[model samples]
Target: MKILKRPAGLILLLLAALSFQSQDGVAGSNLLFYGLAALALIIFFYIVVSVADNFMVIESKQIGVKDTGSMGLFPSFREIFRPKKPEYLEKAHVYTLTKGYDIPMAGEPREEIREPKVTRFALTPPDFFGLMPIPKMLVEEGDTVKAGDPIFFDKKLNRIKFATPVSGEVIAINRGLKRSIAEVVILADNEQQSRDYTLPAATASREELVEFLLESGAWPAIRQRPYNVVADPDVVPRDIFISTFDTSPLGPDLKLTVRGRMDVFQAGIDVVRRLTNGLVYLGLDGRGEDPSPFEAINGAEKRYFRGAHPAGNVGVQIHHIHPCGAGENTVWTLGVEEVLLIGELFKNGRYDTTRLVALTGSSFSDPCYVKTYAGANIAELLSGAGEDIAENARVISGDVLSGTQKSTDGFVGFFDNQITAIPEGNEAEMFGWLLPLKPRASISPTIPVLSDDIEITTNTHGEKRAFVVNNDYEQVMPMDIYLTQLMKSILVNDLESMEGLGIYELVPEDVALAEFACVSKQPLQQILRQGHDTMIEQG
Candidate 1:
């Protein structure tokens, strides 16, 4: 007893006594097993507490617009894990317009005179891959040019041409100060000249077809994710996603874009399907009873995401479904307007980037669709029409929520399909937050407001603020990954954490809506873009 009084010795003696008692079947191994079980129970309880504290809930809610019968903030975990068979039909009735509020532009008034000569140009150069200045000497400084004449060329002397959207004599060979390249100015010749071609149809292998498009000037319409740059035809993607609607403020309705173009749309899908071994997911934002235009495409899968802002974004939709993995490369996504160009490729075996874009806003004098093409200068497109709208409006190439502001010298963005003119409402409202809510205010509320019957304008009420709620990114975001953790890890440049978080599964465009409404106003798209580039560069 005196020797066993040492703590370690006493513990061993106790264990030995227990072992002997168990061998003798007095107290069987049950006592030993019970002790181990008790110890494990303590450890398990500690782990459970730790995990519960660490699990985060990031959510966002709708404040006041129109709230239909959505069940709750986000779908349940059980619903997400065991998805019901989606009876999703590509809505035959495509949305033609979005009714939301937008602040109007404010600027110095300009004259309503039209530029006399408007020279139209092809959007892409022949060797688009190589970097070189747009050619200068194709047309002499004072050469009189007609529609469909060579205006500029690349180093290979392949003519990058322009048609006088209006025929006129060359007024001046203006050069851009920053890039130092030729800018042809022509006075209007006459308003009578017009040329038109019948759209093409689908009929070749994906590579051969892409080459034809590149040569013909149509590749710019197909946008690739990770960088949101024009797709590189050389890199075959996992799949191609075509969005038929846009939820952003002032975005054009896809139903209008696809009018009388169903044949081409179907043909375009067929052509793109040849490029990827994966299924082509066509996204439409509609409910249980709309006539879907995409119903007839064989081998095509259709899905829908019904929500606000990024609900229509391809990257977000992909996030909700099949997220990109660490080593996975690229996926191609495009809007219905751009996909229409695809139909043109198969129909014509050439690139026809020319399409229609809408011009609208309270400041706009006349709101309507304008005939144009990708990469067409705004100066050429908005020449006479500028006077039709208010004097001090800000012109955005895309939409109020996510569009880029372009200068008069700015060419149309390759991905834009709508031009929005909103009055610049930079002036501070007196007691904006203190005032009782009105139907006029655009709020992202979870429940329908009392004045829900009012038609919402371009402006969705709600001052940009910090992200406080758990948005449940996986719910509205169709992809299968944790968005918040992924975003946090990417911003800190924690490469290891990012890898484990599935950084490769996204691009900036996917989080564009979140970036817009965020109070922090973090450059979320920039972060995601950098994360993608970092992975690409490392490879």
Candidate 2:
């Protein structure tokens, strides 16, 4: 027997011996004891074998996409439990957004203005922790742009444009104080926008393809973590990871989405392969019945994971399989559709612009799909979809648990194409927590009594606090990195300790759930981002 299996077998033998000794007194018969012992041993071995099979330590022997470094997501529980150095805190850059009424964290709730419907558009600058200096306007109020035209291009010619995601004339431009670009309003150009156009296929090198992607707005979908910067398509990543699973509420169905888009995804994989000499690994949901699209691709490797929310996360996946290191500088991750665009760009010369966004949530009148360009307006996308929504409701670009709260007037997130609309209901319960949770309520370990096996509705039936639980560590986290310790390190500005704790393996979204679940209302992402910035600055 192999070294590891031998111990397990020994354990079984010991268990059998114990069973034999225990049964020695039964019926004053050694024959009865032997039979019972045999049964007990069989049962014990069955359970042990099942557990080992489920928690198998899969090694990466070949150099396909699945060669995980020390930085990826699949370390064993023993390895994960090993002690590591601690991180310290540092001064952070904090940007506060408009907060009106405070849903009391502990005491009296603070009051603020209540609008019938809050519609505002706020854009985060493209660079990490960047402040937008009077954004240079590329389109005048009266100019007409084709579906795929540049509206704002940076000095490097990395353009940010609007394709009339819903073809429309520029009806209004809402500029804030000192002519800060607030929102660009368009009157839906029905005929022009309604026409569906597909890209014509063509082949190009990785560098040329990246430029084409930037020109077409597809590069925004490929987001890099650590710095939370969008990947510079011009540069090669050490490896590429494709995630076919999301555990967030109302998350996209990768299997359904990837269906029929395999060719485009293949093209995208081909392009990504060109950029990295390292392996490409595709992460599949362990719960999934079907093989992942990456398995269909020639060079990619596949890993299947089973567990709770963060288990399916790409950050966690990367950490388990292959960890990032100094020489293995950068690793890239993307969703299934984003990969299709890569293939679409090479197979067809044009950029695959419109993203397939799922419109789902309790606030939505109907759950559906919308074909919209990147950075399109949420108002336009939610126009007809909010038919059943309550008067006072919240609409977010991503899942309510982890997604940023965007104003109704805000544009869709550059990367998140999903639309999540949920009701901000008015019924105030006398004691909300005391009441029995409905089957629809979404709760994890902190809430307790939330049965693990039950399939509940995607909506968060619980109240939304700025933060309500101190779940910064193991509860919501499924990664190997010690989040609480890492956050402390970032706060105290401990770079070396942070590195030792695998800080480079994390991004804002990796900790977004912690923020959402925090009872203290701590800004988890901000802290993580700040820690990352401090590390970069120190370097």
Candidate 3:
């Protein structure tokens, strides 16, 4: 009885034994070996059921269930191994996540900085969430404005002003369908001039600081979870988080971005510390070389994580550090460069919108970093690579897994730190899907990947199909969110299930890896957005 403690698992093992004993009326030592292998092969969910019976524990919910703790709705890995105490929750905790996938592609940017060929920059309104498609315009075309000049304001949230990144002329107010302002294009001046703003002291009131950030055009850098949208000026966040690295496929190197400008980055952190009453946490790259200067920064606590692609995602960090309050509480996050923007405003007394962007992917001849303003022209950024690229290359603002697609005429996104260009896979490959021997980065076992770096193309081997119910999505996703269930709930507009399944903890980029690993070819990001839009609309 002690040997077979798990009654349910014993029952299943017995059934497996019986099944193997019959062996379709054919018996051999191989059948006994098969039964033994089967028992060891499958002990995940049922491992506890029989064990719990021996211990007189109920696996299912019943009246007056033992209050050992909050019992899981069902058996889980935690049931096999007792859950650890909250010892590391207070202090800095280091996590080595075993789950998660890394997509390696060619064209990592060189460390050296290069002058960009961008003469025109733009501010796309659609890049921001929680705003009307078209903001009330404050400047007309041909109006000369300085770097901090307000170009537009959302009528609903009238206090926040959107500023131009560079001092220039308003060349065009580009519009999309329904005349929604798409891009507020600016013709950069040869000699840039900036308008200085009144900086708040480090000890300023939260309201005063929030107002200052809003008016200074830096509030957009702060985003709230429970829905990855603009941080509401009215709500005070529980805490703030910043990931000081990038681990996406050929992501821009943040160490290069912050090496020489630690002071500016620190200054940004100092000022932002006043916005939240709780601690400001910095998520650092554990895989990078030791003794990084980011660890020495003041005014924030440091947490180290070393893993694949999403180890650098703030959402993942937030989950481990302090599981997002979902809809119950607000958690804010920002990029390192955005912090630099905040720091530059307060420490330098100017709206310095300049940031180092990594231009990557195999389409370019020479990939390197370019110092440019937010929303620089994509064509101009790519023109200085000392060669021309094919017209059909797909340009993406951000990383390959979860980036916005763009044309050469398109501009970089407001929140993007890298621009990726990959060959479009439009033509069919000869039995490529059937054999799949082409050189490319993949996580599937059938693909037979030998190395991480490879030339990635857009040829999706198959089209979207029925939802293949399995752990395919979970294999790549590090977070504990039930991606398959959540995505299915989103598709069906199951608001209650979506909320229960942790929809508040995700944005498109957070789910991009699962999207890539999806066997169903389901657009997870779009579906997540659909769920978010529904929730937002309902609210």
Candidate 4:
């Protein structure tokens, strides 16, 4: 029994068990003898595995891995049979998400960043969630304002300021349903004007840094979790998360967005680090062996994730890294572009929200990156591309799967970096559901997917139906939460069960793929958002 821990001893024990043929040359109780032999082999195999784990630790240390615990060659047998984590979730910071659905859409942007003269831009209050129906306007119609000048402030949270993206005259303050401020349109100046803020010190107090961000109209860049709203100024977040890449269909290569802007990115990270009491985590693209630009970014912790769409979602990254829980366990997330904007704000003391917007989808004549401000006019952007955008084409402010729909006159979303234009599915294809012959995007075997880049239109094909229980949600959604159950809870307004089912770990984009994969054609994102509102209202 004492010799069971050693490989040599296990081998001898195995030999003894296998060689002990009951002395009667294997009698009628051969089943027990066979069991004894199997047990010995299993023990020996576990011992060999223990030795391998020990060797791996030693080898890791030899290569200067200081934190690899226990370098003992003949390690304990328990190491082999220890209940390990499931393959989907590894113990390390690096993750290889196995379950997710990649949407193939055409046309993808070429490896070119186009600098178009986007003259018109707007700041729509509705673009941001959790803001009041109407924010108190700082500048009105025909008011001349600089880039960093305050446009409006939330009535409840007066400290957080929303700034204009460019130096321009406020041409219109469009009102929507119920006199709510729809958009504050600006006729941008050719030679842009900007406000020069005082850059705070690297070792500045949290109050000083927060004050600078608030005053510079960059506070909206730091959004809180659970509600996915603009974080309050008084509360320091538990942690901050940033995804260095995007995996949504026709998503911009974020690396390109921040190209030659590493210094600014690092400075932005420094400011972000001071915003949170805990660590600032960066979720990097781990599919490639090459190091990301943010790998060298200082003052923040780095984590790697490799998988399909939504893997690059900061919410997913947050869920895996340090999931948001109940109470004041608040967290915040920012995009790579937002980080660069923050960096620029602090580095140069200017509020520059320059966007490298990816114009993708089959509707455009040239699908490529366009450099513009945050809320550049869609019509100007499309016309600048020298492509006559079809009046019927459905333009989106972001990716096709989860982006906000927009018209030619619509402005780009504040949080969006990519603009997608796809063909509208106004006229349904005859027998399209019965025989899905078109080379389109679908995880289901029904639609013949020939490549990862298929032309997808805005058609659902099928209407919403009874929620059928199947493996659909699990196949596409890699999170540990049961989406089917969670969606049901949301549908019924069961807040208690929603929290228990990991609702805090989700945002609308996190379940966009799951919604796409649902056979019922459920409006999952809408449902989830409603649930979030319910939770907030109850609280």
Candidate 5:
């Protein structure tokens, strides 16, 4: 009876007893029957324990810990009997983008912008010119325009229009060579009146929906993969990918951003579902304690990804689930905030560009968030805020890795929700590279031991050199493509080789990690952008 307390011991005892009986010339039929019964009892006990474990009083937060503890044996059995969580079958092939000095801001408490008092907005043209050429200016200097009025229109794609965020008079139209518009500064009027449009969500055809999005400036939210350009109205995408969580250093918290706006987020999901005949895959943070707010969203397949940076990238998510092939109509990808913007447009019949923007960096006195429009002036937004940014500090419109560098007076990017301020590393160090005790961050372990609190700067620690093939770039690059080979193809203008190496599957941001990890300090993103532009031009 005591032996029965231990299942393994009881099984062994029964086997020994059965063998003894057989040797003593006991009935063979009775011996066989008892052996079968013992085996059945062992299996029955296992099933009961596994079922009971599911009902155990374990908190969701403690699940990972308890499952790895001494009591973890029961959970293992449960895993065997339970269905696996839905995820990409392909192993996530990527390296950590965070360098030794990239301190994580995830633990910092999120502060919301209480009352945003922005008086000026700038419509930057360069933000929209990724792969496509600059759009033709539609508004002149000192011209009055409504909130949803078009400021510029893409000449090649006439349907794509760039709208202003506020109703105001265009104070200045800054232009560069060839009369290309640089930034159109607008002075916001106290009386904000928006140009209203009719909501067609309930009864509009797919064609109607597409046309409305293109004209209303909501179509830019959806970006096609091959060249990472604006989604074409004529091509129906194979699928749509929405990333809810961003794992970039000092990235905006999506959960906090969409706290009370779940309804809008869900509405956005519905509209996106209608656009694509194929499946709409929504990616969320897999390591969270509670279920993601996006889990309640319907009409889309929810896939979870748990890892470091680029895990939150929609391109990474697409690669794991379904990759883009050459000559294929690319899949469209959108961020959670963009989806909410699209949803708000359909619901309100006017463009609502209000977003939660985070001001972060080691240079900030109190890093916090702000409630501002897409094209709000960065300087005006941080005017009264108690920041410790230096005069020469760099103000980036997005995360440090993939964001664009801008001046303090520059405008926030249309697609950016985070602004980082860091000191410019312009002072040269004597034998800095030779110092083995400096606390600066470097991806290479051969360098000096870096302090975790080290303030990262624009310094390329090392100078640009000849292209060297090393494991550094490949280690951080998670995509299945050959990164070094692809870079070489792009460098040599080998379009066919680049296509064969899965160039269509990449964007500038996708190769940003490789750029950071490269010892050569080469601008990988710029090279990829050139290749992307060339491919589009050749076509």
Candidate 6:
């Protein structure tokens, strides 16, 4: 029977009718050889329960300490995992937090703010346009620049460049509306100089550490995953990752932004392990019980990843460890505060750009941590730090689910660390979606919300209907793709089913929790940034 036209030849024709009905004695009076040995033991226990439900490994009994120094009520992770010692297992893996994410973790950052007073910084130019396109400028408007100079470069990957965070003068380039380059302003002088170039990160060479991180603009702090962009100095990636924890909501704590800078965070993990020869990994935040000065920093491979709000999204730990298919290879990542600002520019040869940020929300009256620099001046770091802003609040700049809405006199986004602010729902709630119990803040547990400290508002509260697939983007996307078949292959622009539904694992803040659990409020991070600008304008 032509070997039953193959399915491994019909599983060897049902194991030769169960081995000739067990040696022709009519094994239990053969009912077609007992239905071919119960359909080969139900396809071998359905391929061992679908490979143990896709390689399940969630153990965790203890380990989840996220109170990076202060800020009142912000516990959960079931108050740091529980069940203590028995020779420690502590595995991790949870991911849920998509319930109307109003998680402003009560304004953290209790201590460290060191010496933040900048004056005016700005920069922006679409935060270094990720990887190329929109670059050009090179100083225009009274020009003076100093703290690392080169105010723009990539006219098409012109060795990248883009510098300037402090050494003042070039007053305002601004631009916008199709002219593009918005915000280049500088102005900060009080003795800031800084142009040096040194190097010798323990004997450079990886082409002199990628030409000293593309001539000191710290090579756009290394992004590259199929299209997170900026890290293609001839692509030799395959694994770098980094993360170092930020669990989203009001994220940003890399151990209180690298406090006391563990020897510049282990000299930025030995200068990003000399730009990859593979394996750097480093995730962290598997809750906590000491051990993490970024797990005593030495040459990464740490991992951990506890739970909630994109478990510190390093592209969901590179989709649970190395899963970026579609023309593969590129991996890279970086952000443990931009690897301590590229190990403080190869251990202080200059270009520091400071950092710390945080600010936070629920319309801050005093949300903390500011030290500033990368485009500092969100109304001068919330002037006197105890904000009141309101006029329908909303500041943003980064985090309140993938930030950006700026304008409290904007500027603080070159890869923002956190600013937020909140409140701008635009009123009008009479019946508020046929109330079933609503105070707002919903990932729809059939609408019951009264308060998870309700304050978030850019209110969609339902409208842009249509695309309903359900299970709310796989209950807050713990990534393995298939978030509504990759948003229906990015709403049918289907570049080969959006790279076979992975879209190089994804970004737009990993689909901002599937666009905050979309019930078709589909903007879905502007359709994954228009499928990463249509795969970078069709290659």
Task: Provide the RMSD of all predictions against the true structure, rounded to 1 decimal.
Answer: 13.0, 12.1, 7.3, 6.9, 10.3, 21.8
Model 4 residue 86 lDDT score? 39
Compare candidates 2 and 5 on TM-score and give the better one: 5
lDDT of each: 0.55, 0.57, 0.81, 0.83, 0.75, 0.71
Which regions of candidate 6 fall more than 4 Å away from where they truly are? Answer: 1-119, 122-164, 169-193, 201-270, 275-278, 281-312, 322-373, 376-393, 404-407, 417-423, 435-457, 460-474, 479-515, 518-539
Tell me how far the alpha carbon of residue 447 in candidate 4 is from the true structure, in angstroms, after superposition.
4.2
Best-to-worst order by TM-score is: 4, 3, 5, 2, 1, 6
On TM-score, the stronger of 1 and 5 is 5
Query: Rank order by lDDT, top first?
Result: 4, 3, 5, 6, 2, 1
For model 6, residues 1-539, the per-residue Cα lDDT tens digits are 23243244567566667666676564555665666677778667656654553333221211333222111222234435743522222443222333223353345545546455658887776765453335787888778888877788777788878788788788888777777677788889988888888776576578778887888887887878877877778777877888777877767676877768889878878888888788888877655555556767787777675556777788877776667654446788888777887888777777877788877767777677777678888887777465565677788888877788877787888778788787787877877778634365566667766555566677777788878777777767776577677666877788888877777778788888678768778888778778878877877
C-alpha lDDT of candidate 3 relative to the true structure: 0.81
For model 2, the stretches where C-alpha displacement exceeds 4 angstroms are 1-136, 155-205, 214-217, 325-327, 425-472, 536-539
- lDDT string for model 3 (248-336, tens) is 88988788887778899988988888888888999987674454468789999888776787889999988877778654468899998
TM-score of each: 0.62, 0.66, 0.84, 0.84, 0.79, 0.32
Q: Candidate 5: minimum summed lDDT over ten consecutive residues — where?
A: 92-101
Per-candidate clash tally? 60, 49, 3, 2, 2, 6
Candidate 5 local lDDT, residue 2: 34
Instruction: Give the alpha carbon lDDT tens digit for every residue of 30-71 in model 5.
Output: 776777677668767766765555445354224433122224
Better of 2 and 6 by lDDT: 6
Worst 10 residues of 3 by lDDT: 60-69
lDDT of 4 by residue, 1-539 (tens): 45555666666665556556554454636755665777778777776766687789879756755334435555455545544443433443566576797787778889887777887899989878999989999987889999989999999989988999999899999999999999999999999878977777767899998888888898898788887888878887888888999999888898888888999999889788887779999998876656666778888888888777778888888776678865678888898888989889878878899988888888888888888889999988878867566557898898888899988889999989888888898876778887776776778875667777677888888899989999998998878899999999999988899999988888899999999988899999999999899998998
